[model samples]
Structures are given as structure tokens and as C-alpha cells.
Target: MFDLVIRNGLLIEADGVTKADLAIDGEQIAAVGLSLQGRREIDATDCYVLPGAIDPHVHLQMPLAGMVSTDDFRTGTIAAACGGVTTIIDFVEPKPGQSMLEALALRQEEAKNKVAIDYGLHMTIPTWHANAADGLKEVPAVVEAGCLSFKMYQAYEGMMLDDVALLRALTAVGEAGGRTVLHSETGPVLDYLRAEALAEGHVEPIWHAYTRPAPLEASAVHRAAELADLASCPLYIFHVGCQESVEAILQARSRRIDIWGETCPQYLLLNAEEHLGGPNGALYVCAPPLRSVEDNRAMWHALAQDALQVVSTDHCPWTFEEKQQPDFTRIPGGVPSIEARLSLVHHFGVNQGLLTLERWVEVCSTNAARWMGLTRKGRLAPGYDADIVIFDPARIKKITPATLHEAAGWTPYDGMEVCGWPRTVLLRGKVIVEDEQYVGAPGDGRFIPRRPSALS
Candidate 1:
């Protein structure tokens, strides 16, 4: 006998969708086909049973820039569960005088007994540490510790890596069979632009976007891709928001490089203009600050053409109260989207005819799982984990914090109309979300260990 059975739902596997019944035994799929019996049964007529989304970019309770995000693992993962995400891979920023593995362990303790869903972490190697020089040595230890990916930043010069150090980290990924993800803004150029903007009294939130405009990003992308190619490393550029960045990725691909890019909903939906005309638009603030409307359209085109491989939330949550804390620079730097990611993508991309339903699942779920190296986590196939989402393609709803599960208590996607919503979310055969509410327990999340990439 199975533990749970989902009946009469159209299953969306990697290839396509088809009618099927899924059976679960403990934490894995026991059977899939027709009329399977289990202790519990879900009637899923007219709904799509898809693999639970694996969001590879999320910052829950992450301390950054001086303030910590308001969403802890409990709230963040609950929000993720309600939105049909099965697994979340967050970052572990190493503190001064800490080992990278020790840093990950501390983060795991912080998340333990608090998360409502499964989670994994990427180690952010700060440049100014002896540990960074020790990066090649620590790669194997962390990979063996279930943390397989490492992130390097270019713009946070004092904190992130230098290009030489960046190259060393990339070569290390090749050595460890691990993957590398980067925040590709060029720090020196950004510092120059910021200095220029400040000297000109461009303190407005919109000016933030203008300050770190496309050329800096374009130059950074071109350089970062070249470095990755030189190391023959599989590099992923995170939250790309401009045309030149896309062009850089395409340029690298043309030269037979295996580099990838991920764009957020904000870049594909909102633009830099949202941050215009003083502090009124400050609520829309985020780093790499939102780009032009033309950039938005370009991002959509990239998604449609497969130039970008994943569409993730970058789901960093914060409250309006927290954001109102005087200096815009002092306030938090991220907006919440875990609860709205899948629906927003479906509404704008699929419902508006920009993306096919299959492509919606691909961008939001499958590709994210694959990119994050969670091979068995992104599809509703026979052998994969029963991480599933039952979504009503026609359910209409407005984005609002009234339905949010995060402690941040706000949504940047607020007040927008959307035409889809997740009905139930199952992670490892356990239904963590039901009827748009979270029912999972804290401590339920497990650290995800990734396999070394085959290409490496």
C-alpha cells in the first residue's frame, strides 16, 4: 500500500503533460499510472500535477549590507510551500574568522526546527579571507558535506573575489566537479559610477539604477564569461537584468562555452522607471536595480528563445516598515516573491501568451532544479522524488500580503491580477501546503547534497 495517492491529475514531466495517477510511499514515488491505492487520496480533476519548483536563489533571514532579511527559514519555506516550491537553496555567507564548512553548519542550525520545507545552501566565499585562498582546499570538504555550489561576487570588492581569485575559484569547481554561480557586476566600474552619481547629487532611488547602468553590467558579463570559458567551468550568472548581459551570454555560447543566465520576475515584469521621481518609488528598490522597459522585453525574449535557462524568485523578503528606515541605502535590499513566483510567471508568461504552459514549468521548475544540480527533484516522473504541485491554471487572484506566509508581511508584486494559483504542494510525498496554506512542520527540511556535474 502507498502512503498517498493523487488521482485524475494531468502530470507534467520533463517532456510534456499527460493524464496519470501518482502514488507515494514514504518520501519517494512508489508508483504512477492508474488507480493506485493509498491511505490518503487527493481529487485533482482539471489541475496540473507538476514537479515542485526548486528555487535556487532565495535569501531567508540572510544578513546583508547591514540588515538581516525578515523571513526566517520557517516563514520563508512555508511561503515556498504555499507557492508550490519543494526545495529552496539559499546562500551561506561566511563571517570573518570562520571556516566555510563551519559557516554552512551554523546556517543549518539556524534553519533547523524552523524551516517548513527542504533546503540546501551555497557558500559565498568572501575575498578578504585566508579561507578564500583556502578555497581549493575546502571545495572537496563542502562537496562532501552536501553543500556543492559556491558563489563569488565581483562588485563587492572588499568582500567578493578579484578576477584572479575568481579564476582560481572557477578552476576549483572544475576540480571538485562542483558548480559556480556569480553576481557579475564589475565592482570597480560600479564604484566609479557610484562616485559619479553621488558627486552629481543623484541620491534618488532611480539614480541607483542609472548609476550601475548597462555598460558596467555588459562589461562585467563579457569579462566573467571569458574567465569561465578560460577555466572551462560551468558558470551561472545570477539575476541578470540587462540587454548587454544577455548579449554577453550569447557571445560566450557562440564560442562553445557552457555558461548560463537566470533572470528574475522583476526584470521581466517591472523596470527601472518604477524607481523614479524620488523616494516614492523606493519601495521597488533591489540591487542591479530594475532596468528599462526595453530590458524587460529583452528578458522575455531571452526566456522564449532559451538564451536564459532558469526563472527563479531571488525571493528576498522585507516589510514596508523595515524599508521605511530613513536612508534608502541603509534599508534592506531585497523584495519577497516566493509566494508569487509560480503564479506570476504563469499569469504574465503563460496566460498572456508569452510562454506556453509547458515552458512555464520548464523555466520556473525543471531548469531551476537542473541548474542547481537537483537532478531528481524537478519532475513528476516515476523514479523522481514525489515533489509535486497541483495548480489550477484558471484560478484568478490578486497578489497581496494578506495571503503571504513570510514574516516580512509585504509583496512587491502586490495589487497585480493573476490567473493561476497552486492548490497543493507535495515534497517528498508529504503535502506541505494544502488549500493555499502551509501545513508542514519545522525541522522537516533536509540539506540537499548534489552530485558532481558530469561535464566536470
Candidate 2:
């Protein structure tokens, strides 16, 4: 007999769905077929059994502008477990003069006994020096350390990389057999616009979107794609937000470039004008700020057509009071949706008939695992880790800060009604969440060592 069995559930995978019983042995899936038996069984009648979602972009306990994101590894991974995300990949940012390897070790120490679910890390190259053999020279060693992906920014002050430096970094990572993830936005353009806006006394939250418009993002995407093509690197763009950017990705793919794109739930459902202009507007102050309603429609279409491959939560957040700044520039920018990503995407994407159930599984789980090299974590098949979610499509939930496990004390999706909440979640064959409450403790999670991207 197996260790556990989930019987009579509609098993969903990236390519299809079927009604079957899933058996778990030890910490991996043992079988998936009719009449599976186990020593312990969970009745999953009228539910969808899926590979737990994998969010490849999140910023728990990240430091920025003299403050830290409210959710650390423990709280954030607990919130992620409650949302059906069984695996997450967060970034490692090195401080001034710190080697990428050293920073990674420190970051791992911080999460050592804290995470509630399996996790991975992506090295962030805030700055690089070729002559001094700074960050670029360590690419091979870092990749060998199991961080097979690296992140580069095109917009932040201390984090942005120039074109030459970006090309060098991309080449190094590509040669080391890893993928490059980019936060693509034109830094110079954003700086000029923000300066102009502040000079004109337009410090309202709305100016945040006004200063970083769609075209700026599109241009930066095009540039990044071109550089990736030149370096022969597999590229993944994060938080893509507009039609222009999608068109750029399409053009790049048309040239047979190996590239992928990701979008967040906020960009697909919340619009700029609606969420960025009021007494509570500070809550929506994230980078590459929200777009128009038309842009939202475009985002859905892109996902349906496979122009975008993943929907991750940038999952960085501060308390409500911490967001109260005198100007948009001073406001801590991020949205907390670690506990709401799955339900939001299901309600809006599947319930609305915009995304097929198969596509939903692809974007929410499988694709992220494939692209990020978490081979055993994202599929519901024999030999894969038994990280699963039993989703009750009939259950309805009205979102509120109190219902969430995030420490941020607020949510961008407050009062939004959604269905298909996770009735049960399993992390590595262990039940971690049941009936929408987290039953798992901190340190239940193990660090995952990843391989090079499947694209590589």
C-alpha cells in the first residue's frame, strides 16, 4: 500500500485533465490511475487535483529604500502554501563589494529554518565589472551551486546594468549554461520623466504610472531581446505589462530567439486609472505600474495564445502605514498576492472562459517549473514530487486581509469574490494546508537545488 492516496479527483496537467486516483509513496508520486489504494486516504470528490503552483518571482523580506518587505521566508512561504504554490524561487541580491557566492550563502542562512515550502534562489547581478573580474567571473561557480538562473535589472538606480555590461553578463551566464531573467524598463527615460514630474509638483501616486509609460517598457524589452539574441542566451522577461511589449516578444520569437515572458495577476485584472488615484492609491504602487483596461484584455489574450508562459506574483509588500509616503518616489513599491494568485487567476481566467483549464495549469505551474529547472516539482506524474493541491471549484471565498496569511496587513484584491480555493495542499507528500488554513510549521521546507533551464 502507498503512504497516501487522493481518490476521485479530476487530475489536471499542462496538456489535459482526467478523473483518477493519485498515490503517494514516501515523498514522490507513485501511481495515478483507477482504484489506487493507500494506508491513508483523502476523499477528493468534486475537486481538481493539480500539481501545486510554482511562483518563480517573489521578494520576501527584500530590502529596499531603507525598509524591508513585511513577509519573510516563514510568513511568505506559509502564505504561498495557502495559495497552492508548493515551490517558489526568490532572488539573491549582493551588497556592495560582496561576491555573488557570498551573498547567496548569507541569503540561504536567512531562510535556513524559516521557509514552509520548497524553495530555490536566483542570483541577482546588481553591478558587474569585467576588468576587475567582479560578478561575471563567478557565473560558472554560482551555476554549479545550483542557482541556474541570474537576474539583471534595466531600471533601478543601484541595480540597473548598462548595455555593454548587460551583454557581458548575459554572455557569461549563457556560456555557463544558465538562463537570464530581466526586469526590463529603460532607466534613463524613467529618470528623466520622474525628474520632470517631481519638478512640476506632480507627486501624486498617479504620476508613478505617468512617468513609466508603456512605450518605455516596450523599448527596453526590445533592447533586452536583441542583446540576448546576440549573446545566444535563453531569456525570461518578468512582469511584462503591455501590448507593445508583447509585440516585441512576438517579434523576437519570430526570429527564433529562445525567450519567455511572464505577467502578474495585478497587471491582468487591475488597471492603472482605477487603482492608482485615491486616498488608498499608495497600496498599488509597484514598479512598471498597472496598465489600462485595454492592456488587461491584451494580457489575457497573450496568455491564451501562449505569448506569455507564466503568471507569478512579484509578492513583495510592506504594511499599510509603511506605504504612506509624501510622494510616489518615496513609496515602497510592491503588491502582496502570494495567497491570492491561484484563485484570482482561476476566477478571472478560467471562470471567465478566457483560459482553458489546461492552459491554466501550464501558466500557473508546469511552465514555471520547466523554465526554472525545477523538473520534479511541477507535474503530477510518477516519480515527480507529490506536491499537490485539491481545489474545490464549488467553494467561494471573498478576499480580505484577515483571510490572508501575508504579514502585509492588506491586499490589492480585497472584497473580490473568487471560487476554486485549495481545499487541501501537499508539500512533498506532507499535508501542509487543509480547509484554507495552514497546518504546517516553519522549517518544514527544504532547499531545492535546480538544474539549468530546459530551454538551455
Candidate 3:
């Protein structure tokens, strides 16, 4: 007999939705057909059975500018469960001169007994100098250890890499059959602009957006795409917030470059005008700050047209106190969206017809699974992991800090109305969330071993 079955739900997929009953045998989907029988059955009439959402970008317990993010693995994964995300890929960031292997082991230890859902990690290469190449020789070891992607920053002070280093790292990773993801923003230009802003006494949150203009991002993206082409590597751009950057990415793709673009809900929904709302606006401070409304519309169209492959929450949450600094630079640069990502996307994308239900599943779940190398976790087909979400499309809720499970003191999308909500969430055939309550325990999550990417 099967372990459990969900009956009569419209199963959403990459192409369309199908009415079927999904049976779970142990930790995997055993069957997907009409009238599947199991030891236990839950009726799901009128609900959409979607593969559990996979958030490919999240920062749990990340340290930045002398402050650690408020949400640790437990709170972060719990919030993810409530929002229908069964698997998350967090980054393994190492300090300058720190061994990548040591950082990976330490990060895994921190998340081992704390996370409440399945997780994978992307390793970050902070210092990629001439000497750094010898260190990166261990990359293949970690790729064998399940960390298949590497992140390089082009903007942040300590984490940023020079173009030479970036090109070399990309070449090495490409040769190793791995993917390279980049945070593309020109550090020198940003430094100059920030100094100009500070000298002009324009230190407010709004000036943060002014300092990092769209052209700088586009310039960096253009340069990175060129470097990826030269290195013969696949590129993944993170937090794409402007049409200028999208145009750059599209141009690279037009040349037949294997590059993927990722945008977040803040970029797709919120505009730079959010920065004009006084000190409270500092809550939205993030790298590659929110962009124009025109860019928002462009991001929506890009997703619908298949130009952008994934939408994730760069969910690095800081507290209200941490964001209350007088200078814009002192304000922690991130916002919490893990709990609101799927809802906001559904409310804005599918409900408004900017995205079809199938595209919704694709961007939020399946595509992420494919891109991040989570082969078994992103589909509802038989033999896939039984990570599922029963979504109620007719449900409506106003987002509020009091209602959210994130440890951040507030939400940037608070008071925003959303239609669809996850009614039930299952991780590996085990119910983790029901009726908006988290039923999973700490350490229930396991590290997912990912295979090497085909892009290389």
C-alpha cells in the first residue's frame, strides 16, 4: 500500500495543469493518475497541486557589514515551509583567505540541525587573485561534495573580484563542468558615486538608489557577459533590477551565450519610489536598488516571454534597528521576501495574466530545480521527491509583520494584498505545513547533493 495520497487536485506543471491524484510511497511520488489509493488520503478538490516551490536565492544567517542576518536556518526554513518552498539553495560565503572547504564544512554544520526543510549551497569565491587559482583547484572536490555553483561579486568591497580574477575563475569552473553566478555591479563606479553622494550630503536612503544608477549595472553585466563568453562559461546574473541590465543579458543571449537571468519580487513589483518615503524606506535598501516602474513592467514581460528563467527572493533580512542608521551606507542592504515571494508572484503575475499558472510553476519551482541541479525535487512526476503544495487560488490575505514567520521585525510588502496561498505543504511526503502553521521540527532538513551543471 502507498503511504499517502492527495486526491482530485489540479496538478500544475511547466506546460499546463492536469487533474490527477498523486500518491506517495515513502519519500517519493509513487503514482500520479486517477483514483490512486493509499494508506491515507487527503481530498484536494478545487486546489492546485504544485511541485513544492524551490527558492534558489536565500541568505540565512548571513553576515554583512558587522551584522548577522536576523533569520537563522530554523526561522528561515520555517517561513519557507509556510510559503510552500520545500527546498532552498543558500550561499556558502568565505572570508578573505579562508579555505573554501573549511567554510563549506562550517556552514553545513550551522544548518545541519537548524533547517526545517531540504537545502543546498552555492560556494562563494571571495578573493580570486593570481594566488587564488591554486586555492580554486579544490573546487572540483566541493563539486563532488554537492556544491556545483560558485558565486563571484563585482561590487562589494571585500568580496569583489577584478575582471582578470573573474575571467580566470570562470574558466576554471567551466573546465570543471560547473556554473558561475555573478553579482554584477561595477565597484569602482559605485565607490565614486557613493563618495560624491556623501560629499554632497545626500546620505538618505533615497540617495542609495541614486548612487548605484542603472547604467553602472548594465555596464557591469555587459562586461561580465563578455568575460563569460571569452571563458566559455555559462553565466547566471543575480537580482537583475533594471531593463538596461536585461537588455545587456538579451544581447548576450542573442549572440548564443548560455546566460540565465534572475530577478526578485522587489524588482518585479516595487519601484525606486519606495526609497523616497523617508527613513522607513531604508527597510527596502538592497544592492542594485529597486528600479523604475518601467523596469517592473519589463521584468514581468521578460518572465512571460522566457527571457528571465527564475524569480527568487534574495531573502537577507535585517532588523528595524539595524536599518535605522543615519547614513544610507550603514543601513543593512536586504529585505525579507521568502514568506511573500510565491504569494506576491501569484497575485501579480498569474492573477493579472502577466504569467500563466504553468509559467508560475516553471519560474518558481521547476526551472530552479533544473538550473540549480536539484534533479529530483522540482517535479510532481512519479519517482520525484514528494514535495508538494496545495494552493488555494481563491484565498486572499494582506501581508503584515504580525502575520509573517520571518524573524525580521517587518516586511517591505506589508499590507500588500495577495490572492493565492499555500494551504498545505509536504516535504518528502511528510507534512511540514498545514493551515498556515509550521508543523516541521528542527533538523528535519537534509543537505541535498547536486550534480554538476550541463552549462559547462
User: Residue 198 of candidate 2: its Cα lDDT?
Assistant: 99
Give the per-residue lDDT of model 2 (tens digit) for 86-194. Answer: 9999999988788888999999999999999999999998864432465588889999999999999998888889898899889999999988999999998899999
Residue 207, model 2, lDDT? 94
Model 3 lDDT tens row, 1-456: 679999989999997789999999999999889878888998889899999999999999998778899999999999999999999999998766777788999999999899999999999987643246486787788788899889988987767888988888888888887888889999988999899989988878888898899999999999999999998878999999899999999999999988999999999988877554554888889998998899999999989998898999999999989988878878889999998888889999999999999999999999888888887978898889999999999889999999889999799888898998999999999999987788889888899988854222
Query: Residue 16 deviation, candidate 3, in Å?
Result: 1.8
C-alpha RMSD (angstroms) for model 1 = 1.9
Clashing residue pairs in candidate 3 are none
TM-score of 1: 0.95
Better of 2 and 3 by lDDT: 2
Could you tell me the C-alpha RMSD of candidate 3 in Å?
1.4
Q: Which digits, one per residue and each the tens of the lDDT, describe model 1 over residues 1-456?
A: 678899999987657878989988888887888888889999899998888987899999887667778888888888888888888989988777777888888998998888777788887867754234454577778877877788888876556677788888888776776778888888877778777877776666676677677878878888888888888778899999899999999998999888889999888888777654444566677777888899998998899888998888787877777677443344466778887888888888988888877888888888877777775788776678888899988788887788667677667777898888999988888778888777778777787777765122
Runs in model 1 with CA error above 4 Å? 130-135, 276-279, 325-328, 453-456
Would you list the rank order by TM-score, best first? 2, 3, 1
List the candidates' TM-scores in order.
0.95, 0.98, 0.98
Weakest ten-residue segment in model 1 by summed lDDT: 127-136
Off by over 4 Å in 2: 128-132, 453-456
